[model samples]
Target chain A: MSDAEERKRAYRLAPCPAYDIEGTESWLEDMAEKGLVLSGDGFFAGVACFWKTEPRQLRYRLEAAPEGTGLWSGNGGLPAEEAVEINEAYGWKYVANRGQFHIYCTDDPSAREMHTDPDIQALALNIANKRARANMITALIYFMIFPLIHLRGGVLLTAVHMGSGLMLGGLLLVLIALGRTVARVLHLRRLRKRLSAGEAPHRKNWRRRALYHRRSRPIFIGLTIIWLGFFFQGWSNENLGGNIMPLEEFTGQIPFATLADMVPAGERAGVILFNPWIFQG
Target chain B: MPRKALSGLTESMFYVLMALCRQPMCGIEVADFVDTKTQGEVRIGPATLYTILGKFEREKYIEVIEVSGRRRTYSITAAGLGAYAREIRRLQRCLDDAASEESQLGRESRE
Candidate 1:
């Protein structure tokens, strides 16, 4: 075979290591700052400049062998053909000479053709918008519904003895609204980044991910209000009996002949019974 | 078989399939054939080409035939041929419509 053909064959046989471009660039830059030399043109083809001499031998080894043959098993090395294929798919041109391979990329009409397709652009946009909306709705539900359920179950109540459930519920709503607004702003920022980069918006769980973060806000606010109510009501005090001994003695002496007698006669019944000592004094 | 017609395939897919249709080739050969045929108009990146090839393999449109030392060779399957035929018919309709439109525009311009 001619020298060119021989080189081409060797290049085709070499294993190409794929690297994420941004990752590789950052890593190389850091290494360069540390006086390390890394060399290669394309994303996957670049090897650390320090390891330039034995590129093949220096390739990182896989912990476990791949399913296929033992050939090209260890190391980040990829077969030349595979490397060329990856480069081509990424709109790169491969030039093989002797034992060396170089990858080149230029503005090609095909790249423009693919990018300018109206259908593809529309599809990408649609996917991103859907993801953003899904996140927003999820955040809203999470912050609102969970607290309401807890309040209904009597597991959470605002203010000891105040019994103003409505006021507490309103405060919960305000907290949730504020939380949702903050979440929306953050989500919009992320969505903008994805759109600008021409990347699809990622949704962890279209249904749950957005809602999960917001749902906790109401629960947290409800818990806080309930705790504050208890704190002010002196529930945490160990000496409630000592603080109102006379009132407690009078209530304890009252005998309920029927279930009806045990029921409060009016809205003022609790206050009248619980604070009788102050009236007597 | 004379290369199955490439009608419905994406331009890159069609060329890759066509390249492998003749003989089992590794990823590089298919990419090179595409570049050669398109006269450097369509360049397939190595990553994109392999990803598509992996999809083709998963869909049973292509299969690995052999591993000659370090070089792996892939051949098109029956389904691949069917896909190529479908793609060709799709392209034919598209071409015919384009031709008719061009002719109508030409006549209009002349008049």
Candidate 2:
């Protein structure tokens, strides 16, 4: 590639492994070693931007911010100015933050660890743990509310109104979100317990997990899209009673057995009409 | 949820209070003081140091004396002094109890 092309190609984007702190740190370090340095931006949107350059070793650390402070929407928040300055003094440069985690990196090989004390690091993680617990509660409430209010007549009746495909897709999505929330809560709890016991977080091979997520996400999203397509198709089709038409003007076979089907050929049969969209009180 | 009150001092917390006994200090200065006081035995990470500082300030145990840019200098409050003194007395009692127990055990062994 030409120089300009190479410069243009220098910028690259990758999916971030959310809530996997050690994995993320190792992933970023690996990227740095491969000459793709994190560009200190876009981590909040569950993606990281990197710039291609000469390969070098770098150490990345994540600091968990206390809940309800900077992350109102889980995007674009830096740690406190004082905290950043103190760490900066110790050779750790403040980088972009994703959710509650403030990312920092240093090129100094001898720079002191961002958290030298495991007990203190565990104390720091308590903030993230609180947020995870809150998220789990919220997800649980959502999971409960969906069935209580909407599925009054049972799943089949609700499914009839909102097409079975849409209903199933919606339920699956809610379940997936709830499952993720539960998993995060459990993971944070386990990690906090380990930290409380004075154990530090250990690095893992992030490539395998990252690649798995990258492959699975598309399949999950594609299935959701297909189900939504089914819903819209069913919603617009006249045969499903989505559209209204006069019985005399209707030439197609009636969906259900009507009064006309039981009457003799010469006798007249009364047609009772009701709106399919409206519920009769 | 009910917030847990800071009742007793951990080793890090005690050392931090000890560091502030002399004069007001910033975050890095406080860490250095604790390190030197403990002869490098106790090293406070940046996060731990700040968290303690923030919590202490919140509970009126410490107060910010000066703020310049990103550096905050903190001085121990009267409440902070009381807490530190209480912690010291508690440690003294613990040591005295251990000494007494050890002496009694030594006598029994000799007997």
Top lDDT model: 2
Docking class of 1: incorrect
Q: TM-scores across all candidates?
A: 0.37, 0.76
Identify the runs in model 1 with alpha carbons over 4 angstroms from their true place: A1-281, B1-8
Could you report the DockQ of all the candidates, in the order they appear?
0.16, 0.66
Q: Each candidate's lDDT (Cα)?
A: 0.47, 0.74
* lDDT tens readout by residue for model 2, A1-281: 47874573344334344677787888889888999887765353355767777899999888887533354553335677888888887889987775557788899998877876666677677767677568667755655444434543666775776666677777786677667667776777787787778777757777666666766656666776786576556545534666667779999887998766866576554322343333464
Worst 10 residues of 2 chain A by lDDT: A269-278
Task: Give the per-residue lDDT digits (tens) of candidate 1, residues B23-70.
Answer: 888887887788798898886644446555765776678999987654
The most accurate candidate by TM-score is 2
The root-mean-square deviation over C-alpha atoms between each candidate and the true structure, in angstroms, is 17.0, 6.3
lDDT of candidate 1 over A1-281, digit per residue (tens) = 58763332211111111111122223333333444333332222222223222222111101101111112433333334554444445454432121111223223444311222222322333333444345456755664445434433432442333245644654566566557556544544554465456563211222333244335544555676764565344433323543355544675545547544655676455675678775789
Chain A TM-score relative to the true structure, per candidate: 0.24, 0.72
In DockQ terms, which candidate is top?
Answer: 2
